[model samples]
Target: MNKILIIVFFLSAQLVYAQENLNFGRQKEIISPQTNTDGTFTFRLKAPNAKKVEIQGDFLIAKGTGPAVEQMKLGADSIWAFTSQVLPSELYSYSFIVDGLKIRDPNNVYLIRDVSSVVNVFLAGAGKADLYMVNDVPHGTVAKRWYESAGLKVNRRLTVYTPPGYESSKANYPVLYLLHGVGGDEEAWMQLGRASQILDNLIASGKAKPMIVVMTNGHTSNTAAPGESSKGLYKPIMMTPDVFNGDMETYFKEIIAFTEKNYRVGRNKADRAIAGLSMGGFHSLWISANYPNTFGYVGLFSPAVLPPSNAASPIYKDLDLKLEAQKKNGFKLYWIAIGKTDFLYKNVSDYRKKLDAMNFKYEYRESEGGHTWSNWRDYLSAFAPMLFK
Candidate 1:
């Protein structure tokens, strides 16, 4: 036993020495949800030079809910370290706020983009590092098909999610156009959110009505992208706006035309719905509002639609996003969901107030969590049931 103990200690020491010699940079650091008995996880950062750093993210960016800052300890060679307990069994996007500017966690491995070119670190399911795409279940089908863009003169990719019996069933299905946030693409929904599995589970459980979910590469051109932010997890305070009417609008129109013609789907706009999260949420709101005849159901989930300076909106002149002009012809269901603690919560509330004042009726559902996929999944699980009803 003593010999085995000696060998184990020796190997652990050697591993520690190797990690120290390699330095923090250019090394893979493992972090997971790491849930505790009390149902929280600690986010640990081993920064060598950070005078002051705090973990900020979509789920727990609120003051004092993040990583341990006051408890930060400077170890040998200026290694700054901190740990904080967070609610476990959920995905969270987090980054270190050094001094004041936001930066990626030097040790985090999980990264997913929310907008045009921006990314935020994410962790899930407390414990050891999870193999990327390791969780497998009978997932919905995801297909990437290329089509010629008449407006762009280039080929484009659009991702489509089909539930079970999509091929076997002879009947047409209702379509839901799902959009991604900035810095994301049509693939983001499949890879990052695991939408197909979520939908499949929902349908299998008979919780959500089965429908074809269409995800297009929100990137129409170089300017518009799936990732549209610089700082991850924080309010999209740092990205340029890509206009909704530009490639996004054209892409949607073309994709719809192609899908309806090729797939078994209802042609009537009344059978169509559009919804998205964050940046994609904004796209759904504006596009559906501008072209009310295009969709019968619209959902804005944690949408960002303040002034153009808010980063989710592009620069445009006095254009009417208010759809009171077509309310009579507008959507059958307009569902708006925003986390009560979401950064754009107030803005959404103000917009809802304006919507109410204009007598534009819609449904507002507030949740307890912030703008994370855990909540977004719940949003999807809840919202899809009401569509095409």
Candidate 2:
């Protein structure tokens, strides 16, 4: 009887393992590497027998509006090396992949809570650019609540912002899901970006509509932001997509669910809109495009497109929603704006060309400044009037 019991336990364990393995499939997971020096870093992974490896991040996109300078070189020791001319001191995040699995940087000293996940990175600019973070504003409430994930068997915490009128009015307002760039948490929009104040000023003056702006953390994994240590450039291994995951695609999947349950928002796609900046812009382009029926408004600010068929990501194949009708009629507004001098400007152009190639109609505009908060603020100010009208 004891032997029979042991056999049953072993069978159950194997079945559980099989179920978990099936979900992960045969994809290889990514792992973050440590920094070596101030301006140089080595990715010490024995992926020699693998097919391909690469690194990428928001550090390049935030520099200018034209095109990001993504640089990578392999060392004689089979380690991947990368460098940049002016890596800012802001908390930028990056990741690496081994085979097919995604992972975080092993050398990061800076970390912030990205919803339920922890991100790694080195802070380059410190408190100089807290413009994207939330400060002690006069009026507003920052609510942190946990959401359940029955499939993953976990409860996740999500941060939300309710404006001044949120308590007095029972009216359901149009919801705009604002995402952060690489290395930034969901709080980026509320804090450094000053979204709450911007909206408050707009609404107070009757220039903008009163609505709830949801700022949720965008990082989907434990990857670190740019620069792990003072050695600086030596640790460029955090640039790959493997580390950042597919970004808000999964976060949205959960966040949309959470928003629906807690907030007074429009139930359908027409009342819901999405927008982001930099890495968040890339995510916006991908998510809004694939899920046209899910969002009536789509805004892209200083977005960086990967290239050619690479498009904006989530890979066109993965986005199963058909958008032909939406392109022609479903969308209320498809807006994109970029600074002429921004390094990501070319990416914006590339995205436009791609959109033109597909015959999708959109409003693409060019501005005068580079990649800075001034341009972003102006863009948001201009963007608010066009929403939910």
Candidate 3:
């Protein structure tokens, strides 16, 4: 009887191993994004019963607009497939619409959450956009840290990226205070912008100086990013009228202090930089102007500058004065970039005209696209290489 029991256990082990091997074989057969040799991509979905299926993605449409829909052909095996044209080399967010309900690619495991929505992601080609892609290079470390905000009366969280060998080396590094736009948190730059990978590749290639990049949550009312607060509430903390008045600029000083005390970063203005996109661009403008001589390098990507209707307001008056003071201080780089067709083009153009009138020394650039992550990522790629030089 003992021999029979041992035989049964041996047979069970064999059965389990065989089952596992079969499952692995099945996994190898699943492919969603099948990249063709000519740079086009074939995305497949196994919705055999769906009457209508379509594909949409960032690569297919302009920024800030709804996805450009492309109908997928139903295959003989009931699988739905769509082959894209030769797309540019870049990371793209996409989804499948089946019978009018949008869904992520089941076979594609990579995903990203923008605001409240989650979408599948894919990388195509190896062009200038390859800087954003992850390569076999020395990688940096990205971490989320909480700091006590005395002004806001809450503990706020920010994402910090330390360059490779930061842990083992005892070197002081310059810090770039990177900010994100509205509806985005500290994670936006790392996720959507792929800032970590960009820095890693640039630093490895000797194109960019290795530095610590601090991504701060710009929303003054919220301690952390959306859905990341300790209070278990997803709703944003609404700022009081007073806080909206000018508290954001003041609150930034605390963030800088916290970063300096906690990290081995330079404390001088020459060792500091500030840049952001959209609302973040606005913050960068406000912070750098209000706090003169704070950052040597300032970047504004598609800045959301409102029309100058209230030239008499104290804020505008203060900005005017601050601009002159900033110019006198002699900054290293004051860079502004906007998409030609962006909705905020007029505002930025008007602000540029004002700066021109003031003789404020700044570099202005215009690209092909509108307000989107693509332009912002490209802006960072261009701007970072010129920092701390």
Candidate 4:
């Protein structure tokens, strides 16, 4: 009976191994976004029955208001191909439209989700984008942890990054609270923004100081990111409840308290920084202003300034008073950046005017793109180097 059992187990293991091998054998040899020697990229798609195929991506400059579109020529081998011009060193996202329906590249395995849309991505090396790449350097560790929120009355999720040597060293490091925009959660910064890679490269090069980065979900209604908490695998929406009502700003202290207790981080304001993009920028502005002594450094990237008229929360009240108090209390750095063509340009301009009227000090940077992740990532690379300096 033992011999028979052994034979049956051997056959089952062999079947499993054979199935794995068969799956590997079925992978195709097609490659998309092939980097050429001349710094151009070639995209390929195998669509035999399709009459026409086109490509839309960030690599091409937008013609008017819509995205840039380029036609791909179909070859004799039933493949569509397009080669781009000599492009700059950057990360690009693209999708193929086969017969008017857009889809990701089947040959490319790498992709990222922005809100609800998913697109394939590729990196062109040798310049500023190198900061987004995983280099041969001392890397930091990223962990997704849950902490109890006293104010929110629930367990919440946050992504934490510990700089290299943190485990072995006995020193407590400064902390940067990095928030994400609307529809984003704790995982957005590390996933879409490449925050971990940027920090790893910057700290390894000694451009930025070694510090801990805490990324939190700004949505107050949700316990965690979609599919990560009590909420099941439901579709994620761009708008959520209590975002602009200042609930998150009022409860942010709980995150800081949790970090100080759990991580090896400094507890004082001088050792803390807060920054975010778009709606996140709005949060940083209020969180830093309302709790004047909490964060020494504040950064806003393409922020949506000004509260809605309907917002009646006390946290939204007394804006000028809070700013005056924050200014009198003093802080290390207040940095603001916006793209030239951002939809919120006028809003940010009005915000600047308010700051100017009060003689509030801040450093402003204006770049070239509209509201985009590309701009945000660049802002982060620039902003991080100036922190804990």
TM-score of each: 0.67, 0.57, 0.89, 0.92
lDDT of model 1 at residue 312? Answer: 36
**How well does candidate 4 match the true structure, expressed as C-alpha RMSD?**
5.8
lDDT of 2 by residue, 37-63 (tens): 463333334345545454444455545
- Please tell me which predicted candidate would have the highest TM-score against the true structure: 4
Which candidate wins on lDDT?
Answer: 4
lDDT (tens digit, per residue) of candidate 3 on 1-389? 69999999999999999999999788546578999998889999878789999998877754455668889999866789999889998888899999999998999999987777889998874786789888999999999999998988989899999999999999999999999887678888999999999999999999999999999987766677777886575645333233334566667899999999999999899999999998789888988987888999999999976524633334434678899999998799999999999999999999999999999989988998899888999999999999999
What RMSD, rounded to one decimal, does every model reach?
8.3, 17.5, 4.0, 5.8
Better of 1 and 2 by lDDT: 1
lDDT of 4 by residue, 1-389 (tens): 69999999999999999998987666445679899999999999989899889999999877797989999999856889999999898889999999999999998999988778889999998998899999999999999999998888889999999999999999999999998998688988987899999999999999999999999999988888888888899889999877787889989999999999999898888999999999999999999989998889999999988889989888889999999999999989999999999999999999999999999999999999899889999999999999988
The per-model lDDT (C-alpha) reads: 0.68, 0.61, 0.86, 0.92
- lDDT agreement of model 4 with the native: 0.92
What is candidate 2's CA lDDT for residue 225? Answer: 28
Off by over 4 Å in 2: 1-139, 150-154, 222-244, 307-315, 318-325
If the candidates were sorted by their lDDT against the true structure, best first, what order would they fall in? 4, 3, 1, 2
